[model samples]
Target: MDWLRKLFSSPVPLNDSYHLSPSYKVFTSAFDQEILAKDLERSRKYAGEPTASADRTWRELQQFWATDLALLQAETTRLAGRLQPSLNLPKSSTLTLLIDHSGSMRGDKIQLAAFVAEVTVQLAIKLNLPFEVLGFTTVEWKGAPVRDLWSAQRALSNPGRLCALNHVVYSDFTDGDHPNSLRAMFLADLLKENVDGEAILWAVQRAKAWSAGPHMVLIISDGAPVDDATLFHNDPSYLWSHLHEVIDEFGIDPDVLLAGLGINYDVSSLYDTSDTITVFEDIHAKVLPLLENCLRKM
Candidate 1:
């Protein structure tokens, strides 16, 4: 987890011309096959027997698709070389990431989320993207307000620092419903008061600003927004109003948001590909294209 800063030497072309390592390709193919098989088996059992065990098996598969595969792909990409032909990427592109730390996020679910979040920021750094990470929970501290929140400070150069931040954030709580209200207020203040909304404003004044031109916000959660209504405006049409605030405050067009809805608690749909991976594929398919479109619009 060392960090190196250098110009893109053997620039990769923008036509999706990046190549995968032979070892990586073989490994991923094998892994995909195994996952596909387990998925199929679980589906068959649930289809034939309709038992709770069969249902549980199906849910596991869904979690893997929704979280694990994304992390694996990201980790592989980080280990791989960055593409060149230089898209003139911003020197720093702010990536503000928030992962759920609620008590409910224990066991394999949290493990998977942690893996994905870590791998993703790692890849972003390897590609020389500037980013920040945060974790939240409601578990109280002594003499502290019920809504008190904490965050790992922003780092400018060290990838290991980012990784370290990831570890600290994840380590703070055990698995439960540790949602903190003060965190949201802090985030709002950060967005509104400090950093001028240059990057994604976070809770407190602990904003992560990118030296790069534009920024994006990435959130990984279990569809549980602690202050969902307040975070955004109350209007239903404004699904991502806070996002809009970032865009306006920064005056950056097409600020991107990439989110992975974390593992669902209900186990019934986990093993079902049709119910899970299909949705994931739909979302995954949209990401690259959406980013490309945003870049163009910008």
Candidate 2:
């Protein structure tokens, strides 16, 4: 009963004096250090040199031996097709991470989302890829609209700093150290409110302006888009239609890749055209594989 009451309650006003720091913290004791370390190691293993384009030359033929044996005899040798690399990712592209810091993503869900974001930043830096990390909740939050954890410009200039996880788990409201932490704090404060998934479109628009090359947006969330502030009507399909309109406005649907990591609910609808929306079960066993596969595609 209390939980339901709190869910419908209005959010408190933001503090004007509170400011998010420019420098971010690389480590935090809020989460299990061992798990974080293992995830980081896994990201490193997956961050091998970006695969080159397919090589169709005879020297690089995949079935050279078989072809030679057939050529020696009177039998005609079948030409071996080009060997495509295991992971042919884009060399010059922008990687945008959109984390859902809504009330539903509290407890273990939020922690896992942060871990995924952390590992992604590390992997992007390791591969020398330009990237941006953004966290979004309600539009009424302090950094409302969207909070930038690491901007594309900052990432390109100080790639070395991004090699480590620069985020903290905010289980409390007053725990604001960096911009990312501040966003987490705001999310914690309003931990029972509905989320606005359309915030992702805002982040995507910002990322497009940041880079002209190909862009990949990965959204980590637990629930569907349900913002009473914007969608006053009781239609459930409004979120879906709104998202499609936003994507159409950009006109970069093909160039932009959308991937979703749904925590509990089936968020596949949120990414209707995406082939990479995976329902979350276990982070290490389920989510990691999906994330790696998406990265390979990028």
Candidate 3:
């Protein structure tokens, strides 16, 4: 774990291009498969069986044209006595994960954060729900502002894409050319800078524009908001005020749930100090229940 701190102590230049370095290959190969498998299994259980019901609309009747007329007519006549219309619940919630990769998250903290992210992503995929993963930290390195680590639009194209990097390691070394490689690097770099909670505002904007369904933002962090004065110099209450403004402007309420997963620290002070926050001294034991509880809330 101390090596992790030493590895990131010296800031490495950000690699904008998507490439998979040898270190990334080694890192992903070690952890991705097992994580993916476990997540997929859990997701399937949560997804349950797909249910089917009779379609009673003219739009559905169009399928009859594609069938053999004789067989279709016979089936239709046989089933004419028991035709009914039904609808299944649509997967309408979009899960947005906001992971804090600040300097404080080095070692086991970052690993657990990544693990939580993997599980959530797999569940979203199994439920056929759209999801986005984002990482936030300091605005700069080497005296210059850094760029966004990963965005929902850039890294995640679909649920299947999760399987593509299932064997890739999460690292910051720049050598290979792949989208997931960049993501791995981004997660690795979470340990490089201080926390900037204002980054959550950017995530909120993206969630508003990208998702049509109810949005759920789950933030995983180890500490309270920091770097506020650095990002917003005008108002001391900028973070809290801005959050309320966004909630009002977007009309996000019961439909939009904001939850936090605090590791080794209580982040409820950063939030409303309500049931919305869940603190864990360690994530290994309670991760599953934690995920399930959040899913239930949504």
Candidate 4:
């Protein structure tokens, strides 16, 4: 695997100020996640305003995933309250929808992602389980100030994750955000560079905090982590290794159920359990097995 080759290689050292950039050697702490979330709030000024958050743009968002969403809702009805069948899981089994807001997921992929989120939320509500919808993207397209700071430094060979990341919270179990409000996540301007490792780690922390027992986290992503600034300065596989490092760390946790639903892209190597689904019809069939597995695990 190309990732394996990049794994053993060393990152080109950089002489810049410390920020959210983290090396593969260190473990991500809860404090780190909090700091990053606060940083994203500070960086929101650099990103575009989310009209969907303030206005009723869900009408338009509904159209993108209408076909798939309708089919999924029907399926939910057919299954009734037996989504987990004989499992009889309690309300403690939380569900976290971790969405990738990278530019690569711009068109049909994003629509499919919305459909997936809707289905997950529907099932969670049906089973009376808690659920949350979260997304991740950079504040700036090119990673402005972070990149600028690196340039001001010696511009060394590698600078990890120079981008100013912006993590999103559309809905949470506290009921702070309504289901309709999740439409804000798929806004066009919100699509930017994605740091998969950072987003996944963030979601893992939140999901763990919400649930007392087993928690299922479905990560919707199209491809590997990609940030021009981060890649240009660091090793080609900097983010890739980071993602694996994070996944491998948490993948073994028996209390956390994790799976990746790729957008027409097979992510078996990236995740312990993953499946691909296109925007075309029959998405529900492909996704059902993963959801079932999560239930069984509980």
Task: Give the number of the best model, judged by lDDT.
Answer: 4
- State the lDDT of candidate 2 residue by residue for 178-200, as single tens digits: 12332232222434333333455
In order of lDDT, best first, we have 4, 2, 3, 1
**Against the correct fold, how does model 3 do in TM-score?**
0.48
Q: Give the C-alpha miss distance for residue 81 in model 4, angstroms.
A: 2.3
**Candidate 2 wrongly placed segments (more than 4 Å):** 1-91, 139-187, 190-197, 233-236, 247-252, 272-281
The residue ranges of model 3 lying beyond 4 angstroms of the native Cα positions read: 1-89, 141-197, 228-252, 269-284
TM-score of 4: 0.78
TM-score-based ranking, best first?
4, 2, 3, 1
Give per-candidate clash totals.
Answer: 19, 0, 11, 1
Query: Per-residue lDDT of 1-298 in model 1, one digit per residue for the tens?
Result: 1111122112122211111111110001110111121233234422343344334543555466756466556634634353424355565445445555544444444544544454445445555555555554321212011111111112212111000010113211121122222112111111111111111333212322223335554444443323221222233322233334443444433344333333553212211111111233433343334333333332
TM per prediction: 0.38, 0.50, 0.48, 0.78
Lowest-sum lDDT 10-residue window in model 1: 23-32
Which stretch of 10 consecutive residues in model 3 shows the poorest summed lDDT?
22-31
Q: Assess the local accuracy of residue 130 in candidate 2 as a C-alpha lDDT between 0 and 100.
A: 66
Q: What is the C-alpha lDDT of each candidate?
A: 0.32, 0.43, 0.41, 0.68
lDDT of 4 by residue, 1-298 (tens): 3432333233334322221334642211111222232233334542345553413345665776577578778887666456646777766778788989899887778767766777777777776778888888876777664565555554645455677777877678886333665555445576888888878877777876776867788888988899887777678898898888777767777877778889978888977777888855646787766776766776
